[model samples]
Target: MDVTVNGQLTQVPFGLSVADLVRGRLPDPRSVAVAVNGAVVRAGDWERTQVGPGDAVEIVTARQGG
Candidate 1:
């Protein structure tokens, strides 16, 4: 299946969970926020959040600045 991540097109395996994606990209998946199809997904729910083809995923990480 194919999904868009941060506006880029990418192919992912079927039945891929949000947690799997995060773990693949970030060393600390807990430090970021995730949204799928414009709805925010809670951290605790990432493991259960399945992403399918044509879905849009936006992942943002926290940054400390002064």
Candidate 2:
């Protein structure tokens, strides 16, 4: 299946959960925020939230700056 991730089109396996996606992309899932189809998904729900094809996903990472 194809979905947009952070503005880029990418292919992912079917029934892929947000948690799986995050773990595959980032070293620390704790430092990132995720949204799908313009709605924010809570951290606790990541495991149950599945991303469907043609969905828009945005994974934003936190950065410390002064």
Candidate 3:
């Protein structure tokens, strides 16, 4: 299936959950926030949130500064 990740178009396997994507891409899942289709998804809900074609996904991670 095709979905947009951080404003970029990408293809991912079917039945891939938000948790799976975060865990696969980020070294620390606890430091990131996810939003799917304009809705902010809590960390606990990532396992239940599934990505589909044309879905908009935004992943933001915390960065150290100052």
How does candidate 1 fare on TM-score?
0.94
Is candidate 1 or 2 superior in TM-score?
2
Tens digits of per-residue lDDT, candidate 2, 1-66, equal 999999999999999999999999998888799999999999999999999999999999999998
Off by over 4 Å in 3: none
lDDT of 3 at 58: 96
lDDT to native, each model: 0.93, 0.97, 0.93
lDDT of 1 at 48: 94
Q: Please provide, for model 1 over 1-66, each residue's C-alpha lDDT reduced to its tens digit, 9 standing for 90 to 100.
A: 889999999999999999999998899876799999999999999999999999999999999998
Query: lDDT score, residue 29, model 3?
Result: 89
lDDT for each residue of candidate 3 in 1-66, tens digit (9 for 90 to 100):
899999999999999999998988897887899999999999999999999989999999988999
Q: Residue-pair clashes per candidate, as listed?
A: 0, 0, 0
Model 1 regions lying over 4 Å from their true place: none
